[model samples]
Target: MKPIEITDIDVSYGAKKILEAITFHADAGEILGIVGPNGSGKTTLLKAMTRIVARDNGEIRLDDRDLDSLGHRELARRVAVVPQDISIGFDYSVRDVVMMGRHPYIGRFASETARDVEICDHAMHLANVAALAGASVHDISGGERQRVLIARALAQEPTILLLDEATSNLDVSHQVEILNIIRDLAGEITVVSVFHDLNLAAYYCDRLLLLKDRKVYAAGAPGAVLTRENIREIFGMEMLVKPHPLTGKPYVLPVYMHQSSAGANRRVHVVCGGGTGSDILHLLHAAGFTVTCGVLNVLDTDYGTAMHLGLPCVAEPPFHGITPESLSGLRKCLESADAVIVTAMPIGKGNLDNLRVLLDYPAKPVLFYARDHSTRMEDCTGGEAGAVLANLEARGALRVEGAEELLARLSRDGSDRD
Candidate 1:
């Protein structure tokens, strides 16, 4: 059975409707993230689960038990919440605040036992707040206070943990630390968190429930749910969704670029690899050019960049040499292109055809793009690649340095958009 399930949930704030027709389930021992824009009812959903806000209509079950069927103390023993930056009006020590998590288990007339103290101490250590146990919560930094809240939640030892932007106050380093701690506990404790940062959600959450306008927009794995179209549709903004370097998970990169029609009708095919054409692809695509790239290996960074920009690319399999089919595809891209730009990527036998093929397009305007003076094409093919490059340059292959100059020259060439 799912650890938590909410079906057809509706919530309202007074007469104002907040959430509608929300349905999702969190698997046991998994981290499920609830993410969306402001006023999207993320916080309200959490409150509904905790009974802090009444659900207008829905069924919420915790481990097969109806949420309403559980008593207050029993519910506390089953669930815990780590909220954003809560204020401690009274001067309670970190230990005291964390110890409060154990109150659900203690008898009404009884005091804390040795085992309760042990649980609190272990929780503090797990949260990296052991050293601050004796410090007043008010005296600690905002980030430290947040960690104490995590320790408190851990002390509860609840089967399900809910977080409302719990790490919003922590710096990147501390945020990672806390997330790592939480992720380590995934197989033991089921977590449902409200995440503001899409990248973090992509990296951490096993499954995501995306809300748009207070309704369930998408629900699935991070890779499937955080598509470029979904982000554009939900947030009304365009973002590049690609694999992160460290984790290989989908990472969201906002396109902080303005669109122009300067190259509106222009098509430019880029010949690049080894990350040499990443920015060039982005630059050309942003400048409103219909860009195509290739002869790139599927595993190449430039290939990744081209895919991110939604450019039609000619790609070969990893470690595979240029195939006849891909070369034919490359020829098609060049034949219809107004211009071709080749970056200063390495030249080896596997990709030597990428440069040699340029000789066939003598009439096409060609630019040998160098991102900087220090990085030029290295001929690894015993001078054959260099000779081909020399031939292209001889046939008027202009060498353009830097993004601005390349853009300027392409703008001039691509003015005939028709």
Candidate 2:
């Protein structure tokens, strides 16, 4: 039987609606994650499942049992929650806090049993908080306290576990530690968690439910639900949703957007190879500049960056010299450009012609750009490349350092092609 099933639920706070038409299910022994931006009702959904808040309409079932049919104590015995963090007003011992999870089982008239103590001990050990059993909850760090909460949840021995970004308050090391523990427990206990970190969700979750504006936006495997288009549409920002190199899971990276159209209508041609041009290429494109790049081989890193950014580029096949067709394309780009910026990439025999072509544009404004003062152009073409650079600098190629300076210079120039 499925561990969780919710259908057509709606939630609201007085007059303000929070969630609408939300429906999904979690399979037994699988980790399902709910991810969405703030105010999208991620926490509220969790609360509804546990009856912390009333759902306006819908059915919620656990293992085919109606949610309303379960008594408070029965629900507590079957479901456990690890919250983001809790305010510890009283200085309770760590063991005291974990023992509370067993209250739903213990009889009201009876004393504490030996089996209860054993369960608490085992839960603490599982959560890595056994070493701090006697410490005050307030005395330990936030991370330790979070683990204590996990241990408490584990002590309940629930069939389903809920975590509301339980590790959000901890440091990276502690976050990973707790997440590792949760992942290890996935098969033994069905986990339904709210995740702020999409990358973590991608790696750990068997499936995902995406929420937007209080409604279910998408639901499926991480790769399908976390696509570039889906993220852009929901979050209202562009992002690079590529696979993580190590885990081969979808990795989301923000496409840093610059708000100003400072270089609008101005054209700049970039002469770059290797991976040196990716940053500036994105910067210029994002700032609303008419940017063009290349005479790079198709296999070059910068070529890939240009393609990814959808910039106009001229390219040739890898390991081949710049063909007549590509050189003509580069010349046309240079002719139309208001300025030119060259990056500090290695000067190889195949690309020495790139520098040679720059000498023909003496009248055009030019800048030798670098990420920093420490990065100099690698002249692999013997002194031949050196001689070409010396000649270009002699004519009027201004040496500009850093992306900001290059952008500032380009932004300041409003003149069209001379």
Runs in model 1 lying further than 4 Å from the true structure:
1-3, 63-65, 69-74, 104-116, 242-248, 255-257, 315-332, 357-363, 414-418
**Cα lDDT listed for each candidate:** 0.91, 0.91
Error of 2 at 6 (Å): 1.4
Off by over 4 Å in 2: 317-320, 411-418
TM-score of model 2 vs. true structure: 0.94
Instruction: Write model 1 residue lDDT over 323-377, tens digit each, in one string.
Output: 9999999999999999999998899999999888889878999999998899889
TM-score of each: 0.86, 0.94
**Model 1 collision count:** 0
Cα lDDT of model 2 by residue, 1-418, tens digit = 6889999999998988999999999999899999998889999999999999998999999978999999999999999999998998999999999999998998889867999999999999999999999999989999999999999999999999999999887888898899899999999999999999888899889999999999999999999999988999889988888789898999999988866778888889999999999889999898888899988989888897788788999999989988888888999999999888899999988988877898888888888999999999999877999999999999988888998888877766664432
